[model samples]
Structure formats: structure tokens, C-alpha cells
Target: MTVRPITITGEPVLHRPTRPVTSFDEELRQLVADMFETMDLANGVGLAATQVGVDLRLFTYAFANDDDAPDRGVVINPRLVLGKISEEDPDRDEEAEGCLSVPGLSFPLKRAEQATVSYQDEDGVQRRFEAHGWFARVMQHETDHLDGKLYVDRLNKRWSAKARKAIKREGWGVPGNTWLPGRDEDPFGH
Candidate 1:
């Protein structure tokens, strides 16, 4: 397994939808392993294929639920069915979300309180499960990446402005920008 460099926002691969995983071969398995290695090193709960410059629709996640139980695995070609988005404003303190691709900043964004995801596993076996709370949030966040949407893109006007400023200040939003875990400093402060 290798820790690949994570792409920043505005990179073409991260901004466009990825192709589905059709071959469940050893190469795909190796990519999944590399993604997990990269995600763990960067201290991210989820890392999508596009984040690492791979245009395949898959993501690796390792997050603990509200009960503190570990929920860790990979999802390929996911079809996420989200519950109604909460009308209540996102509690900034509780709902702030950050991206490994956009590191170091987290912005508040309201999201569905529950979600159900159907996807294939490493062996091309189909699976489905429901989630809630932070786990649900992770599912939604990662699935959005598959559709070429970042969490910042869904921010409201106020938060969007803030995110935009930060992106500019950091000199991001361009192609060929990446941060390698275990080599570069973790802007996410992991």
C-alpha cells in the first residue's frame, strides 16, 4: 500500500464525475489499499478516488459512529439515498465539515440526518446499509465526491464566501496542486 498525494479543489479530476469501477481485479484492490493508507495518514475519515487523482468512483472511509463503534470500509459505485435535509441551520460547532482535498478548514453545512447507501464491495458484491448522525454525514460527504461536488460547493452564500476567501488565500483552486501524507505537513493539522 502507498500513501498517494491528495488533490486540492479545482483540479479537473476532483471537479468532474468519475467513471464507475468495472473491473474488480487486483489493480482495483491495490488502489483501495492505497486509498486507505493515504486517508489514514492524512487523518481523514473518508477519501474518494478523485481526491487522489484517480477518476474511479470509489471511496475509503473509517469513521466511528455515535456509539464510538468503528465503521470502516470501501464503497464502489455508490448510490446514496439521503433522508430529508435538516431545515434547522447547521450548528457550526457540531456540523463543521472539512475535506482532505481542501485541508485545514471546516465550514458549517446542513445535511441529511440519515442516509442509506447501496454499493458494491471489493469483491463486486452488492451491499446496503443505513446510517445516522456523523456516520450519515460521512456517507453523504463521500458520495458527493463521486458526483464531482465538494462540500464547499454546497455551502450557502455566507459560508461560500468564507470558503472562497480561504481557497484564494491558500493559493489553491488550480490544477497540479496536491499534498502528500507522510511527506508534506498536514494542513488539516492531523
Candidate 2:
């Protein structure tokens, strides 16, 4: 599988909602394999089709829980169900999140602690499962990408301003722009 170049933020495909993947053919399988390879090369936990310039509703994720047990899968045309967060839960942490599109920048974003997602597998079989902690956050992040939303859009006013400034300073707001993760020098030192 080839590692496709990741489309940066401000690209039209990254801003617009993706189309559903209706065909589960060899092409779709190849795309999934390429996405996984690209994500691994970029050291990303999750990646959406839009991030790779494919306007299809699909994403791949590779995550390990606290015990180091691995979980990896592909979600096509996913429907996400978020669990309610308890205000009284002191253990809940607003962790910093980064995106493959908006590379080199991270912001502390609060996401649902748990979520259930329904999606089709590569073979077009239906599947549903729940995720928690960092895995849950990754699912929500990738789902946002499919819906034409970015983590920077969910940032608060203070962090939003910072993100905008960084984008402008780095000249990354141009449409159709892209950068290679390891090859390019990260402005934020990642």
C-alpha cells in the first residue's frame, strides 16, 4: 500500500462534507490500506478520507488502551452516538488534540468520554461498537473530519485565536495546500 500525501487544512475537500462510499470493491480496499499506511507514516492515530484528498465517508484508526491492547479498524459511512459526560466526574481530562490536516498544532479540547459508532466494514458488513478515553476522542475527531469540521473549529475563543494566528503565520490557509509530516519542518515543533 502506498502512503498518500495528506491534504492540509483550508483545502476544499477538507472543508466540505464527504460523499458516502457505496461500493466495496478492490479500489475501496486499496484506499483503506493506503490510508492506514499514510496514517502510520505520519504517526497519527486516526485518519479520514478527506485528509488524503478522497471525498469519501471513511476513516481508519489504530489505538491502544491503557493496558496496551491494540484496536484497529476502518469505518465507512459511520454514524456516531456520543455518551453524556458527567459533570461530577473529576477524572475527566480535557486533553490536547492534533490533526493530520492541521499539523504542528494542538489544542486542549473536551470531547465525550465515551461514544458508540455504527459503521460498515471493508466488506460492506454492518458493525457497531463503543470506545472510551483516547479512543473515543480519536473517533470523534475523525467523525468531525467526515462532517467538514476540524478540531480547531471546536476550540474556545482563546485557543481559537491562537490557532488562527498560527495558521496565518505559517501560510497554511491556502486552498489545496499540503505538507509531508516528517519531511517538512514543523512550525510548532510538534
Candidate 3:
């Protein structure tokens, strides 16, 4: 599978909702494989189709929990069901989050503690699963990408202002600000 170039913040594809996956053919399988490869190369736990310039409602995730139990899969045309947070425990926790589209930047953002997603597999089979803690956060983050939203959109006002300034300074707010893995220069500056 080839690692596709990741689109940056200013790309229109990343800002608009993606279309549902209608065909579960070899082309779709290759796209999913390529997404996994691209996500791995970028060192991202989760990636959406829009991040790779494919306007389809699909995402791939590779995550390991505290015990090192690996969780990897693809979600196509997902529907999320968030669990209610306790009154004493706020839904918004200060946790660090980053996006492949907006490289070299990370900030603490609030996310749900639990989520249950219903989605189809690569073979068009229905599946449902629950995620908690970091897994839940990752699911939320990736799902947002399918909806044409980013982690920055959920940032608090203070962090949002800081992120905007950094985007401007780094010249990342324009389309075509992309880097291919293992070929182009490191955009994160190592």
C-alpha cells in the first residue's frame, strides 16, 4: 500500500463533509490500506479519508491501551453515540490533542470519556463497539474529521487564539501545505 500525502488545514476537502462509502470494492480496500499506511508513516493514531484528500466517510485507527492491548480497525460511515458524563466529572478534560492536518501543534482540549460507534467494515458488514478513555478521545477526533471539523474547533478561546497565531506564522493556513512521508522534508522539524 502507498502512503498518500496528507492534506493540510487550508484544504477545502478537510473543511467539508465527506460522502458516504457506497462501494466496497477492491478500490475501496486499497484506499483503506493506503490510509493505514499513511497514518502509520505520519505517526498518527487515527486518520480520516478527508485527511488524505478522499472525500469519503471512512477512517482508520491504530491504538494501544495502557496494557499494550492493540486496537486497529477501519470505520466506514460511522454513527457515534456518546455516553453521558457524570456531573462531578466533566465531559471536557484537559488532554493533549494533535491533528495530522495541522502538524507541529498540540493543545489540551476537552473530549468525551466514552463513546459507542456503529459503522460498517471494509466488507460492508455492520459492526458496533464501545471506546473509553484515550480510545474514545481518538474516535471522537477522527469522527470530527469526517464531519469536516478539527480539534482546533473544540479548543478553548485562549488556546484557539494561540493556535491561530501559530498557523499564520507557520504559513499553514493555505491549501497545498502538505508533506509526503519518507520523501519530503520533515514538516515537524524533528
Candidate 4:
């Protein structure tokens, strides 16, 4: 397993929609293994194929906890089955978010309250999981990467302005439309 370099915002590959994996054979399996190593090396909870220069619908993540236990996983050819928002969702936390691709930039953004997602494991097995709170947020963040979407694009105006300023001052590559302005709606099929 090797740690792959993450592609930043300016990379054209990051903007391309990922292709679905047609086979879960040895090569794909090895990529997943390497992805786990890379995610750990970068101190990230999740890493998507696109971020690592592979245009496939694959991602790996471990849930963050105080114990810092390893919960490494691979989601191959994952697809969204269901998603929704909650009434209890706190409106737009100013918590900073970082990306493996967009290194040196940690910006605050708004995300979903909860999410129920289904995806296939590396072994060709199917699984559906419900994630709320932080876990839900992680799921959404990773899912966005798969769809060629970044968290910075989802921020409200005020937060986005601050993030934009930071990127500019640092001479960082802040992709245009980094945050899609407006109220976010569910991106899942009913």
C-alpha cells in the first residue's frame, strides 16, 4: 500500500465525474488498501479516489473518536440511496474543514444535519448505514468529493467570504464556485 498525492482544486481531474468500478478484482482491492494507508498518513477521516488521481467511485474513511481507534473501510462503487435533513440540525457551524487535495487551507462551512446512505463494500457486499451528527457530516463530505463537489462550495456568503479572503492572502488555489450559494437541498432520490 502506498500513499498517493492528493490533487488540489486547480487540477482538472478533480473536476471530472468519477467512473464506476466495473470489477472488484485484485487491482481495485489493492487500490482500496493503499487508500487506507494514504488516509491514515494524511490524518484524514476519509479519502476519495478522485482526490488521489483515480477517477473511480471509491472512497475510504474511519470514524473519528476520542480513542483514535482504526476503523478503516472502503466503499466501492458507492451510490446514494437516501438522504434528508433534520429539524434538530444546528444552523451552520463555523468549524474548520480541511481537504487532502487542497492542502494548507482549512475553512469553515455548512453541511447536512443527518444522512442515510447505502453503498457496496470492497467484497461486492452491499450495506446501508445511518449516520447522524459528526458521522453524517463525514459521509456528506466524502460523498461530495465523489460527485466532484467540494465543501467550500456549500458555504453561506459570510463564511465563504472569510474563506475566500484567507485563500487569497495565502495565494492558495481557491476554485471558483468553491461554495454554491443558497440553501442546500437533499441530493438523493426520494
Candidate with top lDDT is 1
Q: Where does the lowest 10-residue lDDT sum fall in candidate 2?
A: 85-94
Position 91, candidate 3: lDDT: 27
Per-residue lDDT of model 3, residues 115-184, tens digit only: 8888999999998887888898898999999999988877777788988998898888788878787787
Question: Candidate 4 lDDT, tens digit per residue, 1-190?
Answer: 7766666675665766788888988999889988887676666789888887788988999895332223557776666544554434224444567776655566665556566667888778887766666666777788888888777766667767876776567555644322110222211111
Which residue segments of model 2 deviate by more than 4 Å? Answer: 66-70, 85-94, 181-190
Error of 3 at 12 (Å): 0.3
RMSD of 3: 3.0
User: How many residue pairs in model 4 have overlapping backbones?
Assistant: 4
Candidate with the greatest TM-score versus the true structure: 1
Per-residue lDDT over 40-125 for candidate 1, one digit per residue giving the tens place of the 0 to 100 score: 99999999999999999999999877643248999999998889997777789998999999989999999998888889999999
Return the candidate ranking by lDDT, descending: 1, 3, 2, 4
For model 3, what is the C-alpha lDDT against the true structure?
0.86
Q: In terms of TM-score, which candidate is stronger, 1 or 4?
A: 1
Clashes of each: 0, 0, 0, 4
- Answer with 2 or 4, whichever has the higher TM-score: 2
